[model samples]
Target chain A: MPVIEVRDLVRKFGDRTVLNGVTFSVEKGETMIIMGGSGCGKSTLLRHIIGSMKPTSGSIKLFGEEITTMPAPQLEQLRLRFGMNFQFGALLQSLTVGENVALPLVENSRVDPAIIDLIVKMKLELVGLTGFENLKPAEISGGMRKRVGLARAVALDPELLFSDEPTSGLDPIMTAVIDRLTHDLTRKLDMTAVVVTHDMVSAFRIGSKMIVLGAGKRAGTIIAQGSPDEIRNHPDPEVRQFINGEPDGPVPLKLSPEDYIDRLLGHPRQKGVAY
Target chain B: MTLRAELRTFFFLNREILRWIFLGPFQGRPVRTAAVFRQMVRIGVQAFPMTALTSLSIGLTLAMQGAQELSRMGASAYVPNLVAVTILRELGPLLVGVVVIGRSGSAVTAELGTMKVGEEIEALEVMAINPVRFLVVPRFLAMLVMLPVLTVFGDYIGLAGGWTICHFAMDMGTATYIQRLMEAGHPLDLYSGMVKSFVFAWLIILISCQSGLGVSGGAEGVGQATTSSVVTSILAMLVANAVLTAVFFVF
Candidate 1:
């Protein structure tokens, strides 16, 4: 069975419909990359899949159990099976790096303190942050914080992982390192992953299956979905524009020049009129 | 948010805190006693010097004021009675409540609000750790246990301040002042003040934590929540003190 299945999910904030009838599923051991422009509901979709958000309508099933209406206690139980790495590190500022990573094991497991300490070191080493565990989050660089966040997320060796912009602020070399870790976790451990990222390189490097979300009028719906090669060579101009990082395309950047002038003047435009 | 909505959130959060404290242990999610102790040090032990200074000032001011007025009536010896009654029955808990609301209460709101905005609370949830259980309950337990202790300590310090004024200004012996103070105060006075402190502690922690957890936006939001938490907690404690005073008076 698919590890996660989102069907006809709709999320609305007042009159603004952020996500409109979006649907997708991820099978076990597959890495699904969700890519979109800013404010296109990439993270919103991820939040819903992870049960952090409740949809306005529709369903999300994790491990074949319906989770959209699950009670909080039950949802917490479901959370134990998966791990989510936030966009920023979101490491508790009050905790040391080792304490941050050890939080999950300490809270959820009955492991001995010595073993928990060992596991924390191992997780830190996985993220190349060994011997740096004694430092506070504020004492570290932004990139190091993000790596610590990853270590904390995977501390439990969860069966599934959800990462939001896992490589956004990192250098190209570190981005490759994180992408490799994602690859290793899924390939070696048979873990399922759903990542939301704007990093096309990282997306293409690790994504087994991919979905490109549309922006503007198309807002929360997928514009394209398939293998990396399929998305790379897709026929859709919008998809091509996003993947190639083109400045000019069908993607709307801002208000048109005429509209900008009209807005500033506080007047509706007349057809074919020069400002 | 509307007042009704704000109140609903407050009560809901209160219910969650109580549930986690009482029921979580049965579910094998017991409150972390270590975190509770850590929060006590932060909220209570660290707040000692400030509480001490404030209570001392209030006591000295009350004694001086009461002596001046009573001396005019040729009743200077009544100063001990006045100081003891006021400190033990009212100013003790009220002043300490204000101190805590200003110090630890605002801190709670700012800390929680930052956590909410940074998604640290969400991170805790995603790890199957309930934020209320892991975060709020510790603060709640700490405040509940420590506020009364602080209030009792403040009352004694305030009495000492009053004694300083009486012994030096009135030329009254310490034994005579102590005897008058004991004669003036009933056991109920201390109990009533303790009761008020407990209620104030509840309101302060609940308002502060709810404001923090409800924060959005960013740094500005944390600042706004902290301000609101302090203001609301003080107001709530004052109102509760009035009501409790009336209950004590009537009964």
Candidate 2:
């Protein structure tokens, strides 16, 4: 059975429709990467999957149990089976890295204090945050902070993992390091992972199966979904433009000289934002 | 935000906090004792000095002012009665409420707002922990317990200040001052102030925490929420005190 399945998910923020009829599924041990430009609802979709958000319409099933309708306590139980790493490393500022990583084990289970300490130490070492455990999150660099967040997320040895924009602001080397860490953790644990990102390198390197959210008229809908090589050599110009980060293509750029002049002259939106 | 929106959010948050407080014990050995104890120290014990200083100074001012007016009318002996009644019924609790709102209320709001913006609140949620149960309940209980204790301490210090002025500045005998003070105010007056302190503490706590939990954007949002929490809490406490006074005394 699929570990995560979202069907016909539609979310509207008042007048704006953010995710329109989105559908996807993740099998056990599969790393599915959801990638798109900004505002394509990649993060929004990930939040819905994690039960942090409720879709305006549709059903989400985790482990074949419907999450969209589960009560709070029950949903919390379901969340325990999964671990999530957020963008910008959402570590508690007041806690030491060891405390932050140990939070899950401490709060959820009745394990011995010694066992909890051992688990925390082991998780931190996995993320290369060994002796740095005593330091607070503010004392750490951005990359180390993200790694600590990863350690905390995986502290419980969860079977399913979700990461939102894991390597967003890091330099190329740090990005590669994070990507490798993610890949190693997935392979080592046989965990199912869903990652949302705009970083093509990180996405392509880590994704076993991939989906690209289309721009313009096809916004919030999948334009392509396949293996990494299939996505790397896809035919769609919009998909190609996004994957290659090209300035000019099916994906729209800023206004042209004539359009800029026209907009300055008070004529608004002469063309759609994306073609 | 509109006043109506703010009011709605405040009511909802307070209801949720109260729900967790009353309904939480059945959830199997709920253990937040350490958290509540820490909050009690932060909210009540550490506030003693400021509460004492404010109450004492206000008592002195009231004495000097009342003696100045009553001496002209040859009713200077009534000064103790005036000081006792006023401090017990109004200034002690009100001053303590204002001090706590400024000091601990703003701090709580800022701390929680930063937590919310930094995604610590969301992190708690993702960890299968109820943020309200973990964060709000301990502070709520602490405020309810501590405010009255602080008010009682402040009331005594205020009475002491009044006695100091009466004995040294106004040349009144200590025995006469104590007798008049005892005779002037009923125990109900002190009890009424305790009730007022209780209400004010909850208002400050609920407003500040609601502000913190609602914070968005970034550090700028935290600043805005903290400012709003303090301003709104002080105003609400004053309005509430007037109502409670009318209910307890005037009616």
Pairs that collide in candidate 1 are none
Give lDDT tens digits, candidate 2, residues B1-251.
78899889888888878777777777652748889999999988998899999999988888989999999999989999999999999998999999999899998999999999988898889889788988888999999999999999999899889888899998999999999998998999899999999999989999999999999989999999999999999999999998998898565
For candidate 2, write residues A106-223 as lDDT tens digits.
Answer: 8888889999999989988877668998999999898788888888888898999889888877778778877887898688779999998888878888999998887788887888
Best by TM-score: 1
Badly placed stretches (over 4 Å) of model 1 are: A254-260, A269-274
> What lDDT is reached at residue B101 by model 1?
93
For model 1, residues A1-275, the per-residue Cα lDDT tens digits are: 89999889899999988889888889999999999999999999988988888999999999999999899889988999999999898999999999999999999989999999999999888888999989999999998999999999999999999999999989998899899999999999999999999989899899999999998789888889999999999999999999999987888667788779888889988878776
Tell me, by lDDT, which candidate is best.
Answer: 1
Residue A136 of model 2 has an lDDT of 90
